[model samples]
Target: MNHTLAWRLVSGVKINHLCTPRIAIPSKAVTGSQQVREFSTSYKRSTVMPAWVIDKYGSNEVLRLNNNTEFPIIHYPNEVIVKINATSLNPIDVNMRNGYGSASLNMSRDPLNVKTTGCEFPLVLGRDLSGVVMECGLNVRYFKPGDQVWGAVPPWKQGTLAEFVVASGNEISMKPKSLSHTEAASLPYVTLTAWAALVNSCRLNKQKCPGKRILIIGASGGVGTAAIQLLKAWGGHVTAVCSEDAFSLIKDIGADEVIDYKAEKLEEQLKSKQPFDVILDNVGGTTEKLALQFLKPWSGATYVTLVTPFLYNNDRLGIADGMMRTGVTLSSKVVKHLCKGVHYRWGFFSPSGQSLDEIGLLVENGQIRPVIDEIFPFSEVPKAFSKVEKGHARGKTVIRVTESSK
Candidate 1:
């Protein structure tokens, strides 16, 4: 009888077969026996979904949304999958589309590849996203599925211009309760830049910020707008340089002083205001040199340049690293500090979920608000990118990718 049963089991009839090395096939007389086959339910795998994608580095014409179908799938233990609600455009995106930066446009390639294939074309472009958490990786502890979140994606990973995006657990924070998806979508990159510049680089604490005179060059831009609010909220007096058209907008956002750079020479205007303690110079050109003139002695002012000045030689100006070690000796007299009171610095934004969360709280409490200049549908993403490239937008340009209510 046992031989007959074993023969039937190994004959591949119905569901009868080896269960595994540890578990044996049951006989028909088993208590839970049924007419159908039985399989192990203990080790079921997780499911994955698709995303829109791009493959090559080129213009907007090169973007093909049919790829990245499985984009939000977790490839790393610290990843969290999000259903992108909306994404905003940035100048970096344009550079990325043009294959200007390190991001890929198509097939993934190793950095060591002899050819340019390492960049991988058909890459996703949008960096900042407002979305809902659809899934979380096993190691993700700060967030769970169904949470409303928004923040920047890791620089080299798949971006947020698709239906789904995967971000490191530390790359996102909870969405501000006061902001709609459209409003929150405009913030991440720009606000993070402002935060890093003001808090991390400048090290302006709220107590120390009171009564300090600060000037923001290019005050009407995305980063500038956020800086204006942050500076003012911390009790610093802010002076902004902008075009005539954006003067009122800058003032409305809490700028105590405004300069229309297009209408007048920057130095002539600032000479009337004397030296500033901090100059957050965003524009490069004559404006940069003018900002350097307004720094108070012993007061450190930072000039964050978008355009690197290759023509200006720091070595020739006696501003190199070696110059600092040997204190300036004039006529055998030691000069501890220079009279032209200002410090120069270059800054870039780094991704951080904790910083994003703090900024979100400020936004929720009305301490700051994202300046949203335009909202475009996902299908119109190309047009949005063009708008950002024009460099005239007063605030941020966003792309609505998914239904926010969902």
Candidate 2:
């Protein structure tokens, strides 16, 4: 009887044609079981993936594509693995490639100095990503396998220039249904930085933004362009300062007025539009002092700049001394500006999925659109880097990681 049953199972004969087996298994059951096993096996077998990494920071030539980069795994329950479909370059990425913030970043990575020096080698260096969740940890409640999402990877974390990246649940949100992966990838890092400045630092919002005059210095770049659209969406009057070549692009994104930063008597042009409620300075150096002169004194007006020397100081000095110097500098500047009857702030990027959720709504409603200056295939990442390094982008430079990013 056992021999007959085994033969029937192996030969695919009907159960009735042979003696009954001790345990019955249907054809559908067999297929379902195999499918489950295959799924688990495939997920486990992806132990390594492809990525762009730098063993030592330098110029673009330092970037090397490795096919066997270790696949990131969720070390914490709140972490999720995203399969990157698209990513975009930011100025920070370029700076990081040249070892801009290594000192501070390394300290954050291993606070106790337990790791040896140069442990941050083979660092991946892209900040923004739009992709699908391949796996979620047990503690992740909002996302599951196959959910499309977009987020800015914090500079301290491993970046998105890889096939797979691990991000905390709080760092990402649902991707806007209206945007392709490539388009969505362009906004996160820039938009989040703008949000940190406008909403968090300056306390401007949809309710408060109406009729407020906001000045954006160096307004043709990624953060500047993103700021313009965010302010416009909230009903703010935007004055963008960029080169004459970027005027049309600036205006197209809803800047109410445009000023050429290179024009003769640039201060005169800015003075004519004095008493701006908020000033966002993307250009550092003398512009900070010059732009502050235009803010409305004693009216809760604020000047927020993204060009602070926090990272550079940390990179030059050790973390403790660097932070001390930064604190002293920032405090002195604040006091100096406070006496002038205006608020002064240094804006830094803060990753918030909730903020992305709000921006996603704006994107879906057509209140904001991505300003993509150029798109490059994954193979041409070096060319893309060179394009950004040239320093005259009208908007964000995007990289299409997957052919199906659209």
Candidate 3:
């Protein structure tokens, strides 16, 4: 008699399989009735895998590393499994882990309304990856086994923390030939976000780009650094803002003027050089107000932010009441922008093959360079997130998922 395999996924969860050796019995000694009883109550084995999971979300301490979790397998026809070589972190991952956006995340994970979304245990977390395809589904058209690719996985899907992850064919593109696995890993999510914000949202592409005055706040971080290169590539005049420690770096990369954000009376200094046609803000809180002081008026000035509570509401006061509060706060900001005649837009990271393809081309052609701070092995994922949370990283912090990737 053969053992039956049972699948336990309602929406999308990891289900794994492993083999066990069967014990042989003496054929003459065992009778027909004995065989029936033994087959009905045979010993079953548990197959396990390695993964990082958090039961209830809170701080880093809440995360648990387990070696007995189920492995990731192909769940959809359009998906392909990648043998992940490297992965990187984003602020959105931190937000999701801390329950800041539980309500909406729940809706995305549990689209069928099973009420088991936020409650799903052992949830894997990671977004960007650089790796080789291991298997392809029947409907996958763009890639096959052994092809090196990179892309950002959607938040609702199972993430890239494991050794292998499944992503849609449209979510990835070939990795840049000029970058290493670690260097390639650092670019996708941040690169995609930067390209989308400057090109797609703010219309900073080549046609509208030449000679426009642009201000970039938090210019030492990943998104800010990428934005500086894109703006310079499009021929925009760039002014970068950062602490005194980062001024030299921002300038070497191509900032026409670098301002120390920590300097006393910073607003007055920006006001001194007023009328910026565009503002790309990575630092939130008071950013919208500060940028308006320098934004060009009645001349197509635009303000875009990547960090905002635009989707995640402060839901401590019950979902309905919290939504009402969020509505009032959001409306107030929009009205302020309307009064100022400056276009305010909030940008979010979307999995885009077209954007990734464009960015890969830039890297290949030496148009943009990746600024990486540190490379930690997979064993140090918790430490990586902690480094990012300090809000002072000079560049991106990346994770080398495989031991031999270095």
| TM-score versus the correct structure, for each prediction | 0.77, 0.89, 0.84
Indicate which candidate wins on TM-score. Answer: 2
Model 2, range 270-338, lDDT digits (tens) per residue? 867758999999988999889899998999999999999899888888788899999999999999999
Better of 2 and 3 by lDDT: 2
| TM-score winner between candidates 1 and 3 | 3
Off by over 4 Å in 1: 1-53, 103-119, 309-341
Best by lDDT: 2
Listed per model in order, the count of residue pairs whose N, CA or C atoms clash below 3 Å is 19, 0, 0
Candidate 2, residue 351: lDDT: 95
Ordered from best to worst TM-score, the candidate numbers read 2, 3, 1
lDDT of 1 by residue, 1-406 (tens): 1211211221122323322221234546556443322221111112223334567666778766563254345656677778888888887788767665342222123444456544454567788988897656556777877789999975567788887777988999999888887888899988888887777767786777999888899889898998899888889999998999998899899999898877877678888996777777677667766677677766565545554422122222333432332233221221222334445565566788999988887787787987889888887777887788889779999888866623
**lDDT per residue (tens digit) for residues 1-406 in model 3:** 4653332221233233332213223446655533211111112432345667788889998777777766555656677778789988877778778877666666677767777545666778888889997656556677777789999898877787777787988899999988887888888888788888887778888788998999988889988888898788778999998999988788888899999878866687897785888898898888767777678777778888877664555446555666787788767876788687877777777898777888888788887887888988888889988988787767788889887552
What lDDT would each prediction earn against the true structure?
0.70, 0.86, 0.76
What is the Cα-based lDDT of residue 174 in candidate 3? 93
